[model samples]
Target chain A: MTASSDIDALAAMILARELESALSKRADCGFQLLSSGQEAVAVGVAAALLAHDQLLCSGRSIAPALARGLDPGRVMAELIGRASGPCLGRGGRGHLSQPSAGFFGAHAVVAGNLSIAAGVALALQARRDRSIAVCMFGDGACGAGALHETMNIAALWQLPLLLVCDNNLYSVSTPRAAALAPQRLSDLAAPFGIEACTVDGMDVRVVREAAVELTDYVRNGGGPAFLECISRRYASHSTSARETRGQQELAADRELDPITRLENALLSEGALSAQTAQALREQVRAKVAAACAFADLSPLPVPEEAFADVV
Target chain B: MSSEPVRTRRVFFREAICRAVGETLDAEPNAIVMGQDVGAFGGSYKEFYGLFERFGPARVRDTPVAEAAMVGLGVGAAAAGLRTLVSITYMDFVLLALDPLVNYAAKARFKTGGQIRVPMVVKLTAGAKGQGVAHSQSLESWLMSVPGLRVVAPSNVADAYGLMRSALQADGPVVYVDHKRLFPTSGPLNASAHEVPFGLAAVSRPGRHATIVTHSYMVCVALAACDELAVSGIDCEVIDLRSLAPLDLATVCTSVSKTGALLTLEEGQVVCGIGAEIAYQAQARLGPVRVSRLGAMPAPVSSNPVLEAASLPDAGRVADAVRRLLMEG
Candidate 1:
């Protein structure tokens, strides 16, 4: 279990990095970023969740999809708005979702899917299905009204909802201190009677441990739980964002990069050798290149197709 | 007119909705009813009374006063294969949930290449009563303008029952608007297995002089105006448009062609109202000889009865518009 999880986590981090690199090199066509810095949390949460469990992701949280085992090629296709994309190019990178992959949909609105997660949780409970509904949003989403409403109802109904706030500290350009008053994002959950805690999002193992604990608690009728995973954004809000952040802050955040930390831990534990890690990196790079080529070769949707799915 | 014995019953507008929802809940195991005060409290308007007891909390659940979340919940739940019926207590509150309804639910399937289907029904009460602007405005035109959304505004109890059933059984998302004034008004209802498909106009009263096209509570206002015009030997036809989106322009154009005149009455604002589309269609379809549209003024509905009446399109306004259309001819 440990070996597979370690490999899976490493694979997710590599794919995310490759996706970021590929997207940055491509022309500003409308592709967004949900890569790097936050890969550990996405991979960690995806690792802990069951295959059938539903995931409602934020617009920028693409790493979860990679960890959930979605085809990187199809994801790239979706990002480019090709017909082969998950949403058939109807929704671009911001709205990547394939429910068969247990990814319900990635909402572009910050906290938009919170209520959706609550509703899905309600439906799961009604069906008497032991499977749970999980959602991940940024720290910026904590201030949205949907979050409070959803939390209140999830706790009130005792719905099996696991809300993970990937506290990347910055909501686009605004700092967490400027937006949120509470020191810890999970502290706000206390008023709703939701059991919440802050976890080290930089460590994949730590995130996995926290996710597994909370996931089990919710599945075992422990109701809703909120986990605030503290992380940082390696890139700007989007691929097109030109406003350079403070160099000092960026350097500070880069110091705790989850990918590097995971690599060292795995190397120290003798789970992965330097040569093997290099080979894995090459494999991921090749996969990313193939995915990009696949997306680039995919055809654009025909004009008539727009009128087909409105019903 | 069929050989089979027809079953008919008299029921209140609210009762028709309840019966339709109750029947849908009983039939579909995955069907659920949710919204603010929709469960044990029997809905804010008592439209869902006793449903919680019959269906249990799992099926008949009450939601918080979070309109955005409530509609979003319906979207997510519906996407998860549950046929959900979510009610917005007032049409005005739908503004809070426009993101999910318009951006999410309405466009979900289209974006997903028909891979994801959001089979949910959003039922909200619209129209002017004494509730003022926050609760009285008829925003069906706003929903009607959105593609990928089936907008239905039933005028009578029978259409309400039939349309509700159709909405529940629909393959995609539907926004069903019920006027606040029509709730207490009793009408003949047929609680059968039949469904009222979209884009069909029901001619309530047939006449040769002119045609009055309308829907929801305005249908009753048009009928009343038709009676007033009939007294002067100027018989007018009343076309009640049950569904707005897939607009039954065939029935409307047919009536307009026969009458050679058209008048549209609506409780919504005049700017970009449903009447505008009908007027444009009238010009393009039949090359209109005489046409007029009566809609609420471009202003909020006031709490004062007199001001509200003056701001809205009622029987008197419809009669006046019809008179002007006939006079112009």
Candidate 2:
């Protein structure tokens, strides 16, 4: 294999390793809002990304951000408000930033990144380069007008934009059925004349296949594409959601864990043994311990840092 | 319309605007123009006349009556490296395009940590004299409240040329407010290469007693008032606030600080307007003085010529404000 390919594969592994460690470890520490169900969507997207592609994510993007090579220690550090975090601790967890990985910081405002995603896509077109923009918003975000406006514009201009909606059923406590009008999220882009696709959020391989096709389609001049991954968030909204929702819905979502599906699939294929999966879990635990230690030891930002990085 | 000669230089405001559109296209291969009546009709106000001949249908484009969609398309075009000029005929029509202009075009570049530049200039006409409330609104104040927008209102030929060039070349969105009345107003010529830097006030007339600060066609009224003020022994300096956003507060403040007196003139409503912003800053910077302002009264402008005259601040009101400041001093 080529040196670049080798590096790409290795980086993907490290990112996944770091993410697994960060997610499992920080889940308990950072309000226990773990997204164990959306792992497939995240892994699929992260796998399909070109190194130069920019990933502008919205909140509830734990899996995608981690999958995109966000450092384990930095994710943990950000969660714990440490100096070494992606945003230097100013933006912890949901507001993470990893510029080197091409992961622009996550936005808290729902669907606000729609136009921003178009802007980045436009930037890619302006440079006369081949890089595409990957934006992940929830089904809740599709309801926002900015999303519709951006989709139409992106499609009209044939912009290199890969808009992915990780429909985790609920925005926070409100289900997609409650917040969004159309039952299916991909319906949002149909009127915009953009190509639309859907995938089982529980299957990373399926999602990976879809992403590759869509990315290539857009790269070959197909206009912006929207892919809706009907995923589930197997954890609380944040450290705060567990207290906010009743026990029944959260319990229902737990039954659809993508991590378990991947693990089971690996076992069936003999790529992984039961002992191997257990060992991987143990490794994740150990890595989390090290990252948490690093985060805890990190320093607070100086007073001058406040005025810096205002945007 | 008066039987005025085709003072080509005075009429350069519309020419400069259309020329900038065509020139920008010639300068940058990616430049395009899209709006109602732009392509075939040559624009609703004839500002975009002959653009189709210069750049063809692809670049000199026409868009549907979707104001919000048009702004969104402009944003996309800008992001895609096309210096797109999206002209919404009336400043009042901006109400339809506000969401896109306010939320997307304005903040997209900054919010992305400089990932993109919406180098899109929205050309709009305000201050229509005889056109009723719907058409004559100087909504520059309404649009100025949006952050990340460099709002500009040029009063004369030089500004018309300069501001359009600056807006066309900017890395962010600019709302270039063209006054309906000042379209024919003339000033010093700017030849072929004309550019107006943003956030700098244009001093039409210099004085020491006090400064009459205004923008757009009102600059002419302010100058006329300055002339009247000079007759009455008031050395009134008229400072034209060309670019409204990155406001040249320093210029206004320096003029106010030097002459301990100030008066503001606008064509919009008097309350909670841009004039209020200037008054607040001037009061804090250059102690509370007898500051006066002339603008449209709270009531909307009527079709009656006399009422229309009273609706918007005239040269007499500007001179009266200057006189009030001088008397209080």
List runs of model 1 lying over 4 Å from the truth: B1-6
Best by lDDT: 1
Against the true two-chain complex, what DockQ does each candidate achieve?
Answer: 0.72, 0.18
The TM-score between candidate 1 and the true structure equals 0.97
Candidate 1, residues B1-329: lDDT per residue as tens digits? 65333577788888888898999889999999889888889987788988999999888888878898888888888988899999998999999999888988888888777778889999999988888879898888899889899999998988998899899999799999998888888877754667888888899999999999999999988888878877888899999999998899999999999999999888988689898899898779888459888899988998899999889877777888888899998
Candidate 2 CAPRI assessment class: incorrect
lDDT (tens digit, per residue) of candidate 2 on A123-159: 5775666888788888888777768767766777788
Candidate 2 on B210-249: residue-level lDDT in tens? 9888998888888888888888788987889998887899
Itemize residue pairs with steric clashes in candidate 2.
A31-A239, B37-B43, B162-B195, B162-B196
B134 Cα displacement, candidate 1 (Å):
0.9
Q: Rate residue A217 of model 2 by lDDT.
A: 80
Model 2, position B51, has a per-residue lDDT of: 84
